[model samples]
Target chain A: MFPTPIARARPSVRTIYMFGLPVSLFIWLIPLLAVMLTSIRSAGDIAAGNYWGWPQGIFLVENYMAVFQNSPIAAFILNSFKVTIPTVIGAVALSCLTGFALGVYRFKANLLIFFMFVAGNFVPFQILMVPVRDLTLKMGMYDTVTGLVLFHIAFQTGFCTLFMRNFIRALPKALIEAARVEGVSELRIFWFIVLPLMRPAIAALAVLIFTFIWNDYFWATVLVQGEHAMPVTAGLYSLNGQWIASWHLVSAGSIVAALPPVAMFFLLQRHFIAGLTLGAVK
Target chain B: MADSIAGKSYWHQNQRRIAPWIFLAPGVFMFAVYVIIPIFQSMEISLYDWDGIGEKTFIGIENYIELLDDEAFYTSLINNLLWLLFYMLAVPAGLFMSLFLNQTVFGIRLVKSLFFFPFVISQVVVGLVFAWFYDPTFGLLALIFKTFGFQPLAVLADERYVTYGIIFAGLWPQTAYCMILYLTGLNAVDPEQIEAGRLDGAKGWRMLWHVVLPQLRPATFIAVVVTVIGALRSFDLVSIMTDGGPYGSSRVLAYYMYEQALSEYGFRMGYGAAIAVVLFVIMMVYISGFLWSMYRQEREGR
Candidate 1:
C-alpha cells in the first residue's frame, strides 16, 4: 500500500509490471536455477561444457541416488536430524522457562540476566570456539552428535531466550496478576497459563532452531571430524573434496543437503517469518 | 499437619524471590559454562603460549605485539572493514526489492518465497553455487564474457577480486534475508499514515523517503544489526568458496583466526586465541552498544 497499487496505475504501466515480475525473478534465481539444472543434468552435459544449454540427457535419479548411495550423505543427513531435533526441543523448552522468568519477574537480576543472554547471542564464534571445543573434549563428547546437540542447545538458548522473553513480555500482564491474586503457585501459573499461550512462540522458535542447527557448518567442522557425526552442511564440504571435478555431483549433493531446511521453510513459512520478524513491528 | 502448614507458608513467602531463579538456573548454568566462560578463557588463552595440549606459559600481550606487525592481520582487518561497508548495501537493496514486490498480485506468495530461497539454504551451498557460477573454464560468467568477445575474470582465483567475489555471494542471501524482514515490516505499516502522506501531495521517491521509510525504522535497525553481525561472521563463505586463496586475499578475522588456531597451519593456540580476542574486542564494542540501546528500549517500552 505504500507505493500506489498497480491496480490504480495506468494499463501500460500495469502490463509492464506484470511482464517484469517473472523476468526479474528469473534473473534473481539464476544461480539457483543453474545449480538445479546442473543437478538434473547428466555428467555428459557437464563434460561437454553444456552448463547452460538443454541437458544432453537427464540424470536426476542417478545423480540423486548416487548422492545417498555412493557417499556418507545418508549418514550425514541422519546426523543432522539427530543433532537438530534435540537442540530444537531443548533450546525451545529451556527458553520457555527462562523467558517466563525474565518476562514476568520484577527483580534486580532479571534485566541483567536477559541482557547477558542477548549479548552472548551476538559474540563472535571465534571467542567461543577454542574453549568450547576443549570443554567438549573434556566432557568426552567431542565429534559426537550428542556433543554437537548439547552445544547447539546451549548456544541457541541465548537467541531463543531473547525471542521467547520478548514474546512473553508482550502478553497481557493482567493475566499473570490475576493468577497471582488467586494464590496460584508460580510453577503452576507458568505451566497452566503462560505455557499454553506460548504455543506460537514455541512453534516459531522450533522451526528457527531446526533450520539453524541443521545448517550449522562451523560447529560441525570444529567438533565432529569424522563422517559418523558430520551434519549435511559440513558433510557437503567433505563431499566437495571427494567429488573433485564433478560439479554435477556437487550440485546434486548441495541440493540434497539443502532440501530439508528448504522444505521446513516452505512448510512452516508463517512461523519462520514470525520468528525472524519478532522485533520488526511494535 | 503443623509441619506441612509451616513449609507451605515459608514457600509462599519466598516464592516471589526464588521462583524466577528456579526457572532460570538450568539455562543460566548451561549458557555460563559453554558461552560466558569461554570469553574469559579465550582471553586467558591469548595471554599464554600453548599448543593446546601443553601447559600454557603466560607472556602477556606478546601475541598481540606480533599481530601488530603481521601483514596478513592487517589485510584481514581491512577486508573485514570492507566487508562491513559493502554488506550494508544489502539493507537498501532489500528495501528496494521489498518495495518492488510489495504489491498484491497473482502467484505473489510463490514469487516472494522464491526470492527468499537463497537465504534458507546453507552458506556453504551459497558459496559452492557462486564458486561454480564464477568458475572460469566452464562457468556461466565466462561463457557470457566469451560471447561478448572479452576475457572473463577468474573472480575467486584472482587475489584482487577474491574477497569481493565471496562478499558478492554473501550478499545474495543477506539481501534476501533483509528483503524478507522488510516485507514483513511493510505488511504491518499503517494505511492511515500513508493516506495522510498522500493527502499532503507526496509521491514517488518523496513519498518513500518522508512518508514510508520513517515507518520502516524497526526493519532497518534489524537489517543493520544482522548485516553487521553477518559481515563479521563471514568465515563460512571464505572457507567454502576461496579458502583465503590467491595469496590469502580474502581472509576476514574469523577465517584468519581459524587458519591460525586450527587447520594445517599448526595450531598456534595462543596466537589464534589472541586473534580471537581481537575479534572479540571488536565485537564487544558493537555488542555493548546494541545491548545498551535494546535495554533502553525495554525500559522505555514498559
Candidate 2:
C-alpha cells in the first residue's frame, strides 16, 4: 500500500524500488554470502588475506569431500534422518487422533487437555533435562538415535497437537454431525472423514517438525554422546572445535549441516510457508 | 418405549464424554511423562544436592541462596535481560523487511525465500558463520578493520562485547522469522479497508497505523511469542559459538543450567534443576498470557 502498484508509481520511484530490492537482499544476506564464499575458498586464499576477494580457485567439491571422508559428517547426516523422520511420523500420527477428538468432542477436560499441550509446547527444555536424560538412561535408550527420536516425538506432539487441533477445529462441524447421523462410528468418521481432509495440516506439521528437530542441538548433545548417533547440528559443533583455524573445512561442514533443512524449505516452499505463517495471515 | 429411548439418548450424550478422552489418551500420556511430570520432578530435585553420579542430600534453599549471591548467576541473568531487550529489535526490523519485500516484482518470491534461509538452517551453522565473521585474524570483520587502520575486535573473546555480539548473531535469523510472519500478515490485510481509508486521505503512515496494524495483531502476537521464547532459549548459539566462554560471560539461564548440570563444570543436578525451575517460573508468565488468549479464541469459536 505504501509503494502502491508498480505501474502507477512514477518511473523514477519504480526504478528505485527495482534496484533497491536486490541491493537490500545483498545486504540482508551478507553473512550467508560470506560463508558461501568462504566455503569455496582455497586454503591459500585464506592465508593470503583474501577473505572478501574473489576466490583464487574453486575448492567446493574438495572441501565437501573433506567433510564427508575426513570427518564423521556422513554418519551425522544419516543420524539426523534417523531421528527426524520417525519424529515427524510419530508426532504427526499421534496428533491427528488427539486433534480429532479435541476438535469434535464437547466434554469436561477438553479445553484443559488442549491447554496442557499448549503449555507443554512452550516450556523450556531445561526443566525436563535431567529427568528426561535419567529416564532415557533407565530405558537403556541413552546414546542411541532411538532415544533421541522418542523424546523428539513425545515433545513435538505437544506442538503438533496444538497445530492439528486448531486446524481441525476450523473445519465445518456439520460434516461430522451428518456422518454421525448416517450411523458411521465416531472412529470411522475420524478415519474416513477427518483424516483424509487433514492433508494440508499434515504437510505443514511435517515440514515444521522436520525443521525443528533437524535444527535441535541441545537434546542431541544431552541424549547422545558419541559420533555413532550424533546429528549434524551437534556434529558441526564438534567439527567446529576440531577444525579450529581450518576455516575452509569448517565452512564446508557448516554448509553440509545446513543443506537438509534448506533443501526442505526450498522443496516444500509453499507448505513450509504455510506451516510457518499459520497464525500470521489470520 | 420411552424408557428405552431415554437410555439410548443417554448413551449418545455420554459418547461425547468417551470420545475426547479416547483421542486425548496417547498425547496426554506422552505429554505427562515427557513434559508435565518432568517439570514437577525438576522442581522437586532442585531441593536436594546431588552430583548426577551420587546419592542425593537435602539442600533445601541453599541453591537459591547461592544463586542469589553468585556473580556468574547474576551476570547470566542480566545478559538474559539484555537478550530479551535487544532481541525485540527483530520485530520492527522484521516489519520493515516485510514492508520492503512485500511487492509483486518479478523473482521477489525466490528472493524472499532465500532471505529466509537463515531461519531454516540450524543455529549451529549460524553460530559458526558469525564466529568466522568475527574471527580476529582472517575473518570478514577483521578484514574491514585492517583497511580502516584499526585492530580487529575479537567479539567472542572480549567479555565486554561477547554477549551483545552473540545476540546480534541471533537477531539475524530471528528478524528473518518476523519478516516472514509480517509478510504473510501484510498479504492478508483487507484491501477494501485500505481503499476505504485512502478515500479519507488516510495514506502512508496513517493507513498503516489505523487500518493495517489492527489486522496484523495475530502476526504481532505470534512474533512476540516466538521472539520471547527464542530470547530465553539462547543455549545453542552460546554453546556453539563460545560455550559461554571468554570466562562464561555469555551464559544465560538456559546455558548455565546445562553447564551446571551436565557439562565439564560438574553435574550439580540439584543446583541445575533449581536454575531450571527459576527459568520455568519466568517462562510460565508468558506461557500463561499466550494460553489465556488462545482459550478466549477457542471459547469464542465454540
Candidate 3:
C-alpha cells in the first residue's frame, strides 16, 4: 500500500510489476532450485558435467532410494525424529506450567525468573559447549540419543518459556481470577482452564521446536559421536564428506534430510509464522 | 478426619503463594542445570589448563594471555567483526525485498513462500549448496566468469575470499528470515496513515522512508537482534563450507572455539573455554541491551 499498489499504477508499470514477481522469485530460490534439480539427476548426468542442463534421465527415485539404502540416512532420519519429538513434548509441557505461573501470578521473583529464561535463551551456544559435553559424558549418556534429547529439552525450555509466558500474559486475566474464585485447585485450574487455551501456543512451539531440533547440527555433533545416534544434519555433513564427487547422491541426501521441517513449515505456516514473528507486530 | 480437614484448609489458604513455584520448578531446574550453570562452569574452565578428560590446573588468565598472541585468534576475531558488519546488510535487503512483495497480486502467497524457502532449510544444506555454487570447476559461477572472459574463482580455497564467501551464503537464509518478519510487520501497517501521507504528496520512496519505516520499528529491532545472534553463531556454515580452510582464513570465534576444544585438533579444553568466554562476553553486551529494552517494555506495560 505504501508503494501505491500496482492496481493504481499505469498499465505498463502494472504489467512490469506482475512480470517481475516470478523473475525475482526465480533468482532468489536459484540455489535451492539447483539442488532440487541436481537431486533428480542421474549419476551419469553428474559424471558427464551436465549439472545445469536438462537431465537426460530422471533418477529421482533411484537417487533417493540409494541415499537411504547405501548410507545411514534412514537411521539418521529416525534418530532426528527420536530426538525431536521427545524434546518438543518435554519442552512444551514444562513451558506451559512456567508460562502459566509467570503470567497468572504476581510473585516477587516472577519477572526475575522470566528474564533468566529470556537471557538464557540468547547466550551463545559455545559457552555451554564444553560443560554440556562434559555433563553428558559424566551422565553415561554420551553418544546416545537420550543425551541429545535431554539437553535439547532443557535448552529449548528457555526460549519456549519466554514465548509461552508472553502468550499467556496476553490472555485475559479475569478468566483465571474467576476460576480461582470458584475454589478450583491451582493444578486443576492449569489443567482444565489454562491448558485448553494454550493449544495454539503449544502447536506453534511444537512445530518450531521440531524444526529447530531436527536441523540442529551443532549439538548432534557435540554430544553424539557415532553414526548410531547422529541426526540427519550432522549425518548429511559426514556423508557429504564421503560422497565428494557424487554430487547427485549428496544433493538427494540433503533434500531428504531437509524435507521433514520443510513439510512442517508448509503444513503449519500460520502457526509457524505466529510463533516466529511473535514480537514483530506489537 | 480432623487432620485431613486442617491440611485442606492450609492448602486452600496458601495455594496462591505456592502455585507459581510449583509451576516454575521443573523449567527453572532444567534451565539452571543445562544453560545457567554451564555458563559459570565455562567461565571457570577458562581460567585453568586442561585436556578435557584430565585434571584442570589453575593458571589464572594464562589462556587469555596466550589467546592475545595467537594469530588464529586474531584472525577469527577480525572475521567475526566482519561477519557482524556484513550480516547487518540483511536487514535493509530484507526490507527492500518485503517492500517489493508487499502487494495483493495473483499467486503472491506462493511466491512469498518460495522466496522464504531458504530460511526453513538447515544451514548445513545452505552451506553445501553455496560451496558447490562457488566450485571453481563445473560450477555456475565458473560458467558466469567464463562468459565474462575472467578466470574461475575457487572462493572457499582463496584466503582473501573465503570468509566473505561463507558470509554471503549465510546472508541468503538470514535475508529470507528478515523478509518474513518484515512481511508480517507490513500486514499490520495502518492504512489511514498511508492515505494521509498520500494526501501530503509523499509517494514512492518518500512515503516509504517517512511514513512506512517509522511504523516498522519493532520488526527492524527484532530483525537486527536475530541477525546479530545469527552472525555470532555462524559455526555451522564455516564448518560445512570451508572448515576454516585456506590457512584458517574463515574461522569465526564459534568455530575456532570448537576447533580448540573438540575436533581432530588437540583438545585444549581450557583454551577453548577462554575463547568461548570471549565470545560469551561479546554476546552479553548485546544480550544486556536486548534485555534492557525488554525490561523497559515490561515496566511500561505494567
Candidate 4:
C-alpha cells in the first residue's frame, strides 16, 4: 500500500513483479520441499543415489505408519498435547486476572509488578533449569506430564502477562467505570464484563502458547526421561539416532511431528500473527 | 442509580486499602517464587561446593576463579558472542524478505505463511533437519559437494565449524520471526507519507532509508530484542545438534550449565549455579535496559 502506484506507465515492471513471485516462493521453500520429497521416497531409492530424482517408489503410507508403529511417536504426540493444553489454560487464566489488575488498578507498585513479569519472561531457561528441575523432583513430579505443565504454566505467565496487560490497557476505561457505578463487585465485573471482552487476546495467547510448549525440547529432556513422557521434539531426536541411514523414515517422522503446530498456525493464523507481532507497530 | 459523592469515604477507604494488593497477589507471588527468588538462591548456592546430593560446602568464589581460567568457559563465552553478532543479520534480511512479500499477488498469503513455517516449528526439528542436511555422507550439502568434485566437510564433527553450523540453524527460525515483525510493521506504514516521498522523486533505497526505516523503528527494536535474547539463550539447538560434542566446541553458557548440573559428568550444582548466575547477570543488563525504555515510554504516554 505504501509503494504509491506510479501513475505513469509501469505495466511491464508490474507484470514482471507478478511473474517473479512464484519463482521466489519456490526457492524459499526449498528446505521444506526437500523434506517433503524425501519423506515419500522409499529406502531403496535413497540408497540407489536417487536423492533428488523422481522417486521410483512412493512409500508415504508405509513410512508414516512405520514411524508410529516402530517408535513411541504416538505416545510422544499424546504427551505433547498433555503438557500443552493445561499450561495454555493455566497461563491464560492467571494472566487475565494479572493483566486486568495491572490495567485497571492505579497502584503504586503497578509498573513494578508489570516490569517483573516482562523481565522474567526474557531470562534464559538455563538460569532456572537447575532449581526448577530439582524442585520438580523433590515434589515427585519429574518425568510426569503434570510436572512439565506446572513449569510451563509458571514460565509462560511471563509472556502472557505482558501481552494481556498491554491488551487490557488498550480497552476503553469508560466501560469498567460504568459497570462500577452500577454497583457490580470487582470480581463479578472481571468474570462477566472484562473476561468477555478478552476473546481476541485469549485466542492469540492460546495459539502462541500451544505452539511454544508443543515444540519445546529443553524442558522435555530435562524433566522427562522415558518414552512415556517424551514430546515429539525429543522423540524425533532420539529416533534420528536409531534410524542411522533411514532418511525416508526420519523425514516422515519430522513431518508428523511438525504437523500439529503447522495446522494450528494455519487455522488460527490471524490470532497467531497478531500475538507474534505485538510491539512491532506503534 | 449513582452512589453520590456525599458519603464516598466508605468506598474510598475500602478501595484504597484492599484493591491493589489483592489484585497483585497471585501474579507477584508466582513471579517471586518461580523467578526472582531462584535468582538469589543461585547466587547464594554459587558460593558453595556441592554435587547437589551432598551438603554444600562454602567455598567462597572458587567457581568464579575457576571460570576465569577455564578454557571451556572461554570457548562457550566466545561462541555466545559470535551467535549474538551473526544473529543480528536476521534483522535486515527479514526486512528485505518482508518487502518482497508485501505485495498482493495471488496466494501471497499462503506464501507468506509458508515462509513463516520455520518459526512455528520447534528449533529441535530445525536442528535435526540441518544435521541431516549437513551429514557428511548423504547430506544435501555433501551431495552437492560430491557433484562439484570436492570432499564433504564434517561440519558438526569439525571443532572449528561446529558452533557456526549450529548458529546457521538458529538463524533460520530467527529470520522468520523478524520477517513477521517487519511485515506487521510494514502494514501500519502511512500511505500518504510514501505518496509525498514519491512526489518528491524519492525512490529506491533512499525512500526506504528515509521514509520507511524511521516508521519501522518499533519493529526493528522488537526484532533486535527477541534476536538478542534468542541468541544468548541458545541452548536447545546446541543440545539437539551436537550435544556439545567434538571437544565441546559448541557449548554455550546455557548448555554448559545443563551439562554441569545434570549430565553424566555428575552434578557440580554449585559450579553450575555459578555459571547460571553469570548468565543471569549479563541478561539483567538487557532486561533492565528494556524495562527502563518501556517505563519512559509509558510515562511519556501518560
List clash counts for every candidate, in order: 0, 0, 0, 0
Clashes of 3: 0
The alpha-carbon RMSD values of the candidates against the true structure, listed in the order shown, are: 0.9, 2.1, 1.1, 2.7
Expressed as tens digits, the lDDT of each residue in A11-63 for candidate 3 is 99999998999899888888888999999999899989998889987888999
Candidate with maximal lDDT: 3
Error of 4 at B283 (Å): 1.3
At residue B73, give the lDDT of candidate 3.
99
Native RMSD of candidate 1 (Å)? 0.9
Worst 10-residue lDDT window, candidate 2 chain B: B11-20
Tens digits of lDDT, candidate 1, B226-296 = 99999988899999998888788899999999999988988888899999988888888888888988978
lDDT of 2 by residue, B1-302 (tens): 99998988786767767767787888788878889999999998999999976799998999999899888888888988999999999999999888888888899999999888889989998998898889898778888898899999999999999999999999999999999999889988888888889899897788878888898899999999999999998899999889898898999999999999998889899999999998899999999999999888877865
| Candidate 4 positional error at B228, Å | 0.2
Clashing pairs in 2: none
lDDT of candidate 4 at residue A35, scale 0 to 100: 84
CA lDDT of each prediction against the hidden true structure: 0.92, 0.89, 0.94, 0.88
Kindly indicate the candidate among 3 and 4 with the higher DockQ.
Answer: 3
TM-score of chain A in every predicted structure: 0.98, 0.97, 0.98, 0.97
- Sort by DockQ, top down from the best: 1, 3, 2, 4
What CAPRI grade goes to candidate 1? Answer: high
Error of 2 at A167 (Å): 0.6
Between candidates 2 and 4, which one is better according to DockQ? 2
